[model samples]
Target: GAGIKSLFGGEITQYVTMMEESRDEALQRAIEHAKDLGANGIIAIRFDSNEISDVMQEILVYGTAVVVEKE
Candidate 1:
C-alpha cells in the first residue's frame, strides 16, 4: 500500500491517523499512571517515537507527577 502511494509522494493520511492515535493512547496511559500515584498534576511532559520496523512503531510519554495545593 505505502510502496505504491510513495510513488506520488504526498501526505500519507493513514499513517498520520495511526500515529496520532498511538500518541494519544500513550499520553492517556501516562496520565492514568500519574493519577494512580495520587498526583494532582504533571510537569515536564515529553514524548518520543521510534520505528521498530517498517510496519511497527512505538510512542512513549513521560513526565513528573506533582501534587498541587491551593494557597
Candidate 2:
C-alpha cells in the first residue's frame, strides 16, 4: 500500500464555512498528492482533527493510493 500526506488550514470554532472549506482543501490536497505520485486510485480514506488553539483546529486527510498497471 502507498501513502500520501496532506494538510489544510486550521479550523475556527463557530465558523462553519471555514471548517468546511478547510476539510475540502485538505481532501483536494490529498488527491493532488496522490495524482502527483502516479496513483491510479485511492482507498480506505480517513481524516483526523486536532485542536490548534482556543478557537482553532487543524484538519488532516490521508488515505492509501495505489498504482495499477493496465493490461
Candidate 3:
C-alpha cells in the first residue's frame, strides 16, 4: 500500500507535518497487509518516496512478512 500527500504551502512546518503523516499512513498500511497475510512480524522494512508532481509526493513501505515461533 501507499500514502500520498500534497504540498499545501511553503511553510516548513507544513511540509514536515505532511511528510510525517504520509510516512505513518504508509507504514500502517504495510503493517495491516502483513497481518492480513498471517505474519507474526515484519523484517527488513524499507521506506521509499517519490515526487509525483511539483506539489504531490507518494510514499511506499515494504517489508518481509514472516511468522516466528518461540523455541
Candidate 4:
C-alpha cells in the first residue's frame, strides 16, 4: 500500500495510522464474533488488505475460533 504523510504534522504517517486503527477494530470485531460462537480462543490469526481505490483500502482480519480443554 502507498504511504501518506500526516496532514497535521507528525512523525507517524497516515498510512501507518490507518493500518493500526483498522487492525485494532478488526481484531475487536473478530474476538466478539468468536465469543458469540462460544469460542475460548482464536488461533492462526491473519491480516490482509487490499487497495479499493487511490484513497481507500479494505482490511480483513481472519482466524480460527476454537475451544480449548485443560488437562
Candidate 5:
C-alpha cells in the first residue's frame, strides 16, 4: 500500500486518500455531535490537519451549530 504512493513528483495519491478519509471521518463526528445538541444545521465549517507523529495524523473539524425554523 505504501509502496504504491508516489516516487516522482507532486501529490502522493495514498496520502491524499488518507487525508480525505480522515477529514471525512472528522466531519461526520462533528455532525453527529451537533445533532446530539439538537442542531438543525451547521455553518462556517472549518477543517485543520496536522501530523501528530511520524506515523499518525490528526484531522480537526468544527462548525457553528444552528437550528433552522420553518418560519
Candidate 6:
C-alpha cells in the first residue's frame, strides 16, 4: 500500500440513484476537495455511508490529498 491519509467529507440529501452514479458523485466531491486544497492528486481513496435518518442518508468520501512534486 502507498502512503495514505483520510481527507474531506461531503453529504447531500440522499438522492436515490444507481450505485455507479453514487460512486461518481462521491468521487467528484473528493476530487473537488483536493482541488480546493491545491492538491495535485489523491491516493488511497475510500468511501463510507451513514444513516442520518430513515429517509435521509449521508455519504462520506475520503482520500489522501497529495502535493505531487514534478521532477
Best by TM-score: 1
Error of 2 at 49 (Å): 1.0
Instruction: Name the regions of candidate 6 deviating beyond 4 angstroms.
Output: 1-19
lDDT value for model 2: 0.79
Per-residue lDDT of candidate 2, residues 1-71 (tens digit): 11222346543444666777788999999989999999977898998989989978999998998887879
- On TM-score, who's better, 2 or 6? 2
Better of 5 and 6 by lDDT: 5
Pick out the ten consecutive residues of candidate 4 with the lowest summed lDDT: 1-10
Best-to-worst TM-score order: 1, 5, 3, 4, 2, 6
Between which residue pairs do clashes occur in model 1?
A: none
Query: Each candidate's TM vs. the true structure?
Result: 0.85, 0.69, 0.81, 0.79, 0.82, 0.63
**Residue 53 of model 6, lDDT score:** 92
Q: For model 6, state the Cα shift of residue 37 in Å.
A: 1.0
Each prediction's whole-model lDDT (CA): 0.84, 0.79, 0.83, 0.86, 0.84, 0.72
Which has the higher TM-score value, candidate number 1 or candidate number 2? Answer: 1
Give per-residue CA lDDT, model 4, range 35-64, as digits (tens): 999998999999999999998888899899
Model 6: lDDT of residue 47: 85
Worst 10 residues of 3 by lDDT: 1-10
Say which candidate scores most in lDDT: 4
TM-score of 3: 0.81
* lDDT at residue 28 of model 3 (Cα atoms): 91
Clashing pairs in 3: none
